[model samples]
Target: MRRSVLGLLALLASTALQAATSVRYCDYPVYPPVSWSDGKQPRGLAPTVVRELFGRLGYRVEMVVLGNWQRCLLDAAEGRVDVVLAYTSAQREQTLRFSKVPVLREEVAVFANRQHPLAFNRLEDLARYRGGLLFGESYGPAFDQFVAQHQNIEWVSSSGQNFGKLIRGRIDFVIQERRTGQLFVEHLPGAGDIVALPPALSVDYLRVAVSRRSPLSAHMAEIDAQLQQMADAGELERWLQESEVTYRDMVRQP
Candidate 1:
């Protein structure tokens, strides 16, 4: 009877360990000042915020870097991953459950080569020149509709490639978030030749989204409660500031 009781206790402990929730958080290769992968590892603002939020929630997180933004979204949508850090959109709401509070406000801006400087006071002004864009990114509803209607836009896989093309006079301008564009321009080889235009093209909120198929789906209320608490306590802003400083130091490294 003593031996049987000991064996039953061991079985219960094993089952408890197996039931612990583990989340696979997917991120794309590049976004910077927001989120990016260093080829082998993930880094940047979003990742930092996620680490704090989920770490405190007691969930085991495994960071996975998908090839691109589209892949990251796809993985999250299909429930292959537990979550994805992304910009919130009406379309995305159909696939993932977004956090109640946003992690950051993303401001998209136009970038042009210094030699062929360009500026636009309105969206219509952009129609005058050819532009380069990432393969599967949306600036916002208005800009996205504009890009779809226009035919001169070129698509590239990476910001580095877009900047390279812009420097070679292959494209008239490239659109990206203000801070991200600045970071790329400051670090890319022909740094001095690229510049971001004044005023922003669009501003959107970015948030953490949990996959519908994740086991954590049942705990959405609790997850959002923690996020709201962090926001209320100003912890989210502090994380963003810390991330900005860290990214600046990384870019300045030799």
Candidate 2:
């Protein structure tokens, strides 16, 4: 009887070890409608889609909403998390593996205080002005290079802070995602004075990046397959719609 019990215990332990694994990812707080934190963990469309995708693959998700975007990337580089659901940049490609199919499309825009209309026709038009950008953010490779070489941009902690600085005349413009900026305009105090300048700066694709050092890096193909299916089924769009409405309600005044 004792021998039989020992064999059964070993079998159960092996089965448990072979069960579905848990995958952890990073999330930037205050990036509403796409990524945000409820002060406890990451919330918004990005986390929603992450949970759905990982759930489909039978993996439990753990969301890490640390300090800021810079902090999140640092953790990713150190292999502290398994994935980062964010916009792709040249620097990120070096340390992480990305799926060819994008997870979401984001429009980058320059927001100016309505009281101070900007005569911005292109990236060059803003050379004289100072802009606020969230820390560790990249609009894309081309614009990022332009900013690096020509533009005067100040890095800050959150998009909300950028908007605040813009209203206070501390910065000339705020570079932010169009949708999230709209949310801030509608939900945040004094944000009503902001307007997104026409002619988007860049149309970016948000993709899930798995850390190269992570064991799950081997599952990129599988992850992409599921992402494609989710896109085909219109799940991503539906989730965006739902997430935006939910977020607005959360921040909107009664």
* Worst-scoring 10-residue span by lDDT in model 1: 12-21
User: Which candidate has the top score in TM-score?
Assistant: 2
Q: Which 10-residue window of candidate 2 scores lowest in summed lDDT?
A: 11-20
Write the residue-wise lDDT of candidate 2 on 59-165 in tens digits: 79888777788888878877899888777777998888888889789898989998877788888888888899888888878778878887599888987788888
Expressed as tens digits, the lDDT of each residue in 1-254 for candidate 1 is: 99999899867644543365677888775777677665567778788777777777766788887666788888888999988877777777788898877888878888988899776888889998999988768766777788878877998788888889999999999998898888767778866878888877888888889888876666666677878898899987887777667777887877
Runs of candidate 2 exceeding 4 Å displacement: 1-20
Best by lDDT, which number? Answer: 2
Q: How far is 121's C-alpha from truth in model 1 (Å)? A: 1.2
lDDT comparing candidate 2 with the true structure: 0.83
TM-score of each: 0.86, 0.89
Any idea how many clashes model 2 has? Answer: 0
lDDT of each: 0.80, 0.83
RMSD of each: 6.7, 6.6
Distance from true location, Cα of 47 in model 2, Å: 0.6
